[model samples]
Target chain A: MTASASERLTLVARPLDRQVASLSALAIVLALVDAALPTPLPGVKPGLANIVTLLALYRLGFAAAVWVSLLRVLGAALLMGSMLTPGFFLSLAGALSSLMLLAPASRLSRRLFGPVSLSLIAAYGHIGGQLLLARLWLIPSDGILYFVPAFALAALITGTVNGLLAARLLRRWPSSKH
Target chain B: MRLIRPGDVAVFTLAALTCGLVVWACWTQSPARTLSIRQGGALWREVSLLHNARYHVAGPLGDTVVRVEDGRARIESDPSPRQYCVGQGWLEHAGQSAICLPNATSITLEGARAYDSLSF
Candidate 1:
């Protein structure tokens, strides 16, 4: 009986932790890849890591998706030596704001809300959160508003691309029941 | 499930409209070229953004040093207990502001936009 109980924790807790950790690692790698890409603007990027987040959301659940995003931000910050900086906070704000909005939208009937819509919502929330934080703390100026149009356009494009990629991956992903 | 759904198109269209609206609104806004300083709730002075100088405004506490340089302005120092105005850093764009409630002095960047909510 004692051995079986110990096995339960190992089988359940350990696997979930490992799964979340692996997903987070994948997201961190994608983030690093994104950083290496050149862009016309400072803040605009493809946001490739969001693909993993969408996968986690669709596969495991929203809680697992949250874990992946949180770990990705922390791990990427440590790797990039941006810990506790404004950049780090901006990333965190973006992730949390996106997830906060993504949660309810995910609950929408699956027939209508797919990866594309969720991705679009997440992308917009991310930029909105970053701008809000910048206006409140860092820049504290209306100049930040000027960047909105550019950021929104970028989010729209990137969100669509990421959604398509996620959808394709989902087609091949094995939907094994836990 | 289908990769592209009608709901996705609706979301995209709505977002794109919003993007266009922001672009137009931002484009129409004239550059903030003036800084208005008020003392004890009355208009005291208006300065051009081109000026590079420091001002000493008398308030309840003491002289609050307002610095303007390189097309930006800031409350550099103050006699107040908490230096929140000083902490606000710089005022660069239209609608930016810093209020020194303890000193009864404030500065606002004006010259563009119709809505006051954006300033907040």
Candidate 2:
């Protein structure tokens, strides 16, 4: 039996909807895990959910990736109960900057550096945003220096992990050839 | 394609250098012997001849009390959901500070003299 064009479109739309829903769910889970995970050092987070952002960038393109990044930050802030404070603003700034840098990088270099490098770039961008926001909004004078070591440490650890995870996910669900 | 470009290297190098300068500044600053905390128009707490010690300040309302003794410091405040500051542990060195936002309290250690005295 030959399916009508509209029916085929519906079939396609259904998977797309499911993907969006599951991706959003994944973002929230990552945020919870990020808040719950204990670190030996204070102010350091693993950024485990960044893998979703990278994956989205590769598979769903830039707009979808941006949405994922924003959702993750918002979800994390809500989970941590820092939603309306300086911490939320800081996270938002970091997410925006990180995605801004990553979206372009993913488009240009996904074939070469793969997910790990993208993750590293995104991590660096996020820290850069936080530092900039701290200098601008919170402590204008010396607060920026306080978290340098911790932020650097986070970037190193989280970027590596996110990159590795992104690679694995990509391999599992290889991009469908058009 | 090389993901790490020359520009990335340069930016990272500059960042490293800047970080080194900050660490150096932190280490060289001396400890303050006398300090004062002010809220609004009144003195909140004033301490003189603050010795090198560790102190812990904890309370339900985020009101932080500073305990400094023999190179140990502890900060106790209403644990916000994140608890980032609580996890920061005791800050013992001079030129260090811990902030508890829930209580709007901040503690800083400085060189062993008042700012006016240093000017003389």
Candidate 3:
């Protein structure tokens, strides 16, 4: 009876798990695409991948957003063969720092903040975190500050554009997905 | 159905203002005052960028003429086949660098606040 009842201890995937998996997969795809997209300047990226995280946060809650974002970073790194590199750490730092501001601000007043504001905040946080890490471990010189303004400007543009996209996506998200 | 809320304007204004402040502050770093030249990965000399000057550096490829003026430096002429160093235009920022790899010579801009030791 025991052998029949408990054989192999079958695992069941919860709805939250499925949601997180699908969302993370989408994010990772975007991250890879962003990586392939060329920029005139080093360290400049459009960061369209974070749109998935924003959508997940709005629909599935903070926990789902966190899982989606983290998994996306890790999975993309694995696919890109950049795991454990300094570049990987930079991505992780940016993701975590942005999330630090993202959930609380979004939960505070969704009516006021919406997606654009949150995207801008995340973009700045991402750049700030990467710059700090670059100073501490990579460049190891005040010369890194030379890049602050350029990076900040890039973040502003990308953040706003991505945020707008997320807003439109959120507005159009399918009822079936909900 | 609003594309941008009132709070979105606040966020945009705040972000733009902060970015402008950063731009002004970074751009205002006292102009670079030193130009360091290296030959074969060794320190050749440090020239004053505050005034115009010219120096000829000899290498395996031949002479490389460096002209410094208007707080800017450049490889006025290089004997390297590609002329890539000469084509680099101007070196203006604190961390700007031009490496004439074939000629075994390089130049870097060094400001009061920051100096880039890495040249490539």
- Show where candidate 3 strays beyond 4 Å: A1-6, A174-178, B31-120
Best by lDDT: 1
Per-residue lDDT of A1-178 in model 3, one digit per residue for the tens? 3467545776799887998899999999999989999997777999988899988988888888889999998999999999999999999999999999896777767667778888889999899999999999999977787789999899889988998898888878753554
As a TM-score, model 3 comes out at: 0.69
DockQ of all candidates, in order? Answer: 0.47, 0.05, 0.39
Q: Of models 2 and 3, which has the larger TM-score?
A: 3
Q: In candidate 2, what are the lDDT values of residues A1-178, reduced to their tens digit? A: 8876777443455565566557767987987888788977644788878888887777877777887888878877877889879988988988899988986776663344567767777888888898888888787965456566667756866776777788788778768721
TM-score of chain A taken by itself, candidate 1 = 0.91
Distance from true location, Cα of A91 in model 2, Å = 1.3
Give candidates' CA RMSD values in order.
11.2, 15.5, 12.4
Q: Flag the better candidate by lDDT, 1 or 3.
A: 1
Docking class of 3: acceptable
Q: Please give, for residues B4-117, the per-residue lDDT of candidate 2 as tens digits.
A: 444444444554554466555544444444444433334566555346433334444644555655544545543456655567666555455556666555565555432322
Q: What stretches of model 2 exceed 4 Å from their correct place?
A: A1-14, A40-42, B1-120
